[model samples]
Target: MVKWSISILLIMLLNLAVTSLGNVPNFDYHAFYFIHQWLPSYCNQKGTKCCYPPTGRPAADFTIYGLWPYNDGGNSLQNCPGSSYDVAPLKAIQNMLQKDWPSLTCPQIGRKFWLHEWNKHGTCSKSVLDELAYFHAASNMKNKLNIFEALSKARIIPNNQFYQVENIKAAITQATGYRPFIFCNHDAEGNSQIWQVIFCVDKSGTKLVNCSGSPQGQCAYSTVKFPSY
Candidate 1:
């Protein structure tokens, strides 16, 4: 009788394991945001100098904020239950994060920020199922996109001058073949600045795709600043 009960329990556990593996990959989530942040505006808004490595200031460029997973209807999820992240795998890619994805906040060069992001958003992305893949994919995507080069090729240099929102959008759209959604912030001078550029990508984390619904850019001004370092 005990053997029969144990057999039944084993079957149930196997069924559950299969359900989870199928469900996570097949979940109908829509898109990803290659969330690139403009560090100058972020630091200016925070009223602090952007943190850097001992070598000196990291490039005054768009560093990775995150690669967030978004749903079709505009809602998103966070920190999937039982999802945990470890800092060990990240050590292999530590140099890349330090240069391309450095923490711009002060006092210490830390992993807490990355941990927070993974807990908040990375945990929710089925495409990047584990810690190693999660950070590796983000680092790889940063190199793939290279926001600075894309803008530079379009003759859009970050000299703190105001550029028309449409032109900015066009530059990215032309370069990437996907219309990117822009987010803006006002500097201390109350002029609008381009703060972040968000791109929609596929579940595999490789290609740029159309966003089902773009996040609205908050810059009310016709022209927005892309500040210099």
Candidate 2:
């Protein structure tokens, strides 16, 4: 009787672990909320960890911070609440740029300005939309490429082989035109992550440094940089 009880307990524990590991959060407004609550804590911000850890081993030299908006084949703009359009992330990036180049205009910042806006709020004002259209038209003329094709070429391999250094550099170049400000990625197991830009460096290399963490301890490090994009 004692042996049977112990075996059953072990089986239950194993099953629970598998179930927890396999669960991926559904993408919705609640997804952002879940990421906000869980990611920081998982990275040891407040000494709490996630239920399912990331698969990538933590890096010793890099830090990635801030959350990159995830679009799970749905329109984020359609899902955001309120009339204001939830443009907090673009405003945040604009504020950052103003600190460096006070005279910079929205158009001068190039595709990055639009990418940041779309990534965060899922939509943009008419001016930004016009700028994006112009940028895409010009880019196609110069490179014989379209936005859809570019994005298709830029997709990352969503597997354990994610930390490919060459692929990372290529992705950064393709997305941002300039080299990455940082080089970090989302862990497969976590619902959300954050990458904060510490500061800029004047050196020939990348300008920003960031830290990344999962909603669990699966990926934890401070020096991760954003990919060139």
Candidate 3:
């Protein structure tokens, strides 16, 4: 009778363990969020001193923050199962990365940044399974969007001037056909400043689309500053 009781207890524990495992969040993703970060705001927000790239200063325009994978409802997924980052796949666009996606902090650490991005975010993407595909899709989208030109056409220069959030959104929507989620942080003076612009793309990574889940982050003021690099 004691043996039977012990067996039943083990079985119950095993079932509970399996049930808990099943309740853990899934890693599979349904969409992508192409996040672009402005260099100055990023460096300024960190509080720690930022190291400049040996090559030169990163371009003042939007550089990639990351390409994140999200569920249909826009919940983000990270470090999915069976995901590994290999820079070998990215040789095809290494030059483009240097030009457009150069790490603003210690350019030599670009590899580390890419690796972290892959393990943390890119791995969750189904559409972009490997490093090459992941980066290619992100770079291609940046080229296609030409966000700087869109803002330029609207005369929204990043000269530390404040611009209306609506106008900024309108300019981007007119350029990409989909509205983007703008994220910002406060400067030393507590002035709200632009930090990142994120866009949702389809699973195929072919077209820009509206985010199914509402975008996160809200500006404290109607107008926000865009600090120059």
Candidate 4:
């Protein structure tokens, strides 16, 4: 009887392991790796001294603000410094939403925005917002809106030219099937104003990434990887 019980326990453990592994998506790590390679070099060459967080942007970083003026506060948007709010991340988020819910509507999408923006403020940082918008739009939703509806109702774009939340979401989802995680990172130095996608899971099972760059060069990119299980 004891031998039979032990065998049964082992089988259960094996099944559990299999189930966990199944949940892991077949991710295209190469695309992300290539992006990383470009970031550092770009920062070294093109990062301007006058840009927001005033010190200097990094050459290569995963966050949108590092690449463009999405969240960098200096621009006209004025939500936060270094907070330009890129359309790409928002598109990614939108795509994810569509994947989660195929029949989503404008109102439903609005509810999500309100929840993420207000209720779950901390969890959905700038990066996450981008990802959410991107995924939500890309996954589904066939109808396209004019400039006014897209900007006012959806809150996707800042101006007519730039791809706001709706447009960003659609673009990202079309590019990548999966949406990236978003979070903030701050180290010992006081710099603290950066954003990026959470590439890996942290030790506590949370997705992790680094987003830090202050007015002084003191705060810069740090090696932030997901924690081990």
Candidate 5:
């Protein structure tokens, strides 16, 4: 009789543990960042040298970086199970991608950087999107938030001019109706330059959402440089 009670108690305890764990939230990814980099700023950073894509020099613009998944704790999710990156599915928008998402590294190659982004970050976003859908969403996002145009409208040309970080954020916010987080890099002379503009995105990866956490890097300087291409 005592043994039976002990066994039942143990079973009950095990069941309770399982139930508690099951109720725990899936904090793996509830939001994401639609991140893009300023090509001129990137090329101007200290100890950096950039090469144009085979098609030719891309225009002076903020280029597509990645659609990164983020957990509630602000950790980026990566390497989840999903299809590997393939160019076949992206043929329809190949030209657009080449223009917006081109690799600026030495010995630039077509689709290589994209393939890396897909396998590393895009795969982890499979619960909300597929390979083709992911790339398409990124393209749509780029079209929607024309950062260059937004800044240009504010007369913030990338001609080695310095601007307050708050003003930069204000321009993007005024244009998109969603606030952006800016990251900075240092120029050859160690002056801070804006590198990436990141926007928060919801789980659907469709619409804009407010970001939760603070941005990394030093964008808090009194003035940040906007380098020319």
Candidate 6:
């Protein structure tokens, strides 16, 4: 009788293991997108005007958009429960964020943009990185890949003329040895322009990997404009 009970317990444990193997955490993200945007095109998006952060107008380059986490199915995590936006911890890195991740939207009122990013994307990343660590990780990633400089070196100047998006990707791939995802948005004149450049990173938000689980925002063109700011 005892042996039969022991055998039943073993069978139950085996069943549990098999069930657990198929049950992946729905809340978890497999990869992160180190996303940044062309500030000029960002401001040019419909009904938007450039509103520099209190720190002043940022340089003409790709600025940090967000470090978004996504699953294998390309679903991005946002506004995770329990992680609220707080600027208190960001005091130390405020200056750095201002320069690298400044918001071009109006009523900046200090760290509001950062706050939004933290609440939306950073919160979802709490399992992998805390608030300070997440911002630092994004700033570090932005510093590592100078996308603007890479394009310039490749002679794909952003002077409001259309360039083949493939060439743009090639320039980035050649520089970083990994492909990048370029997303587009409509300029005020209804022309699709290169808006966002996304790079894939490992779960820790460090080390560039081949692109995966990153958003391809509204881009269906063979050639797109890299507009002037």
- Give the candidate number with the greatest TM-score: 3
lDDT of 1 by residue, 67-103 (tens): 7877777555566655676898888887788887777
Q: Mind giving the per-residue lDDT tens digits that candidate 2 earns over 130-182?
A: 32332222222222212223333676422223344444445645753533332
**RMSD vs true structure, all candidates:** 5.9, 21.2, 2.4, 19.9, 3.5, 4.8
Model 5: worst 10 consecutive residues (lDDT sum): 213-222
Ordered list by lDDT, greatest first: 6, 5, 3, 1, 2, 4
| lDDT per model vs. reference | 0.77, 0.31, 0.80, 0.29, 0.85, 0.86
Where model 4 places Cα greater than 4 Å from the true spot, the runs are 25-27, 30-229
Candidate 2 weakest ten by summed lDDT: 30-39
- What candidate 2 gets wrong by more than 4 Å, as runs, is 1-48, 51-152, 183-229
| Model 3 regions lying over 4 Å from their true place | 1-14, 106-108, 126-128
Pairwise lDDT winner, candidates 3 and 5:
5
Highest lDDT against the true fold, candidate? 6
Please, what is the TM-score per model?
Answer: 0.81, 0.21, 0.88, 0.19, 0.85, 0.85
Stretch of 10 with least lDDT, candidate 1: 23-32
lDDT of 4 by residue, 132-218 (tens): 432333222212212223223444322212222224334333444333333323323322222232222111212222322222222
Model 3: lDDT of residue 128: 53
The clash number for model 4 is 58
Clash numbers, per candidate: 0, 30, 0, 58, 0, 0
Model 5: per-residue Cα lDDT over 1-229, one tens digit each: 9999999999999999999999964636878888989887777766777887778988878989889998877777777775888888899989989987877876545688898899889988888788888888888898889999999999998889999889999999999999898888888889898888999888888899988875455376777899888
Residue 110, model 3: lDDT of 71
How would you encode candidate 6's per-residue C-alpha lDDT over 80-149 as one tens digit per residue?
Answer: 8867887788899988988899887777534888888888888888998999999999999999999999
**Candidate 6 similarity to native, TM-score:** 0.85
lDDT of 6 at 81: 80
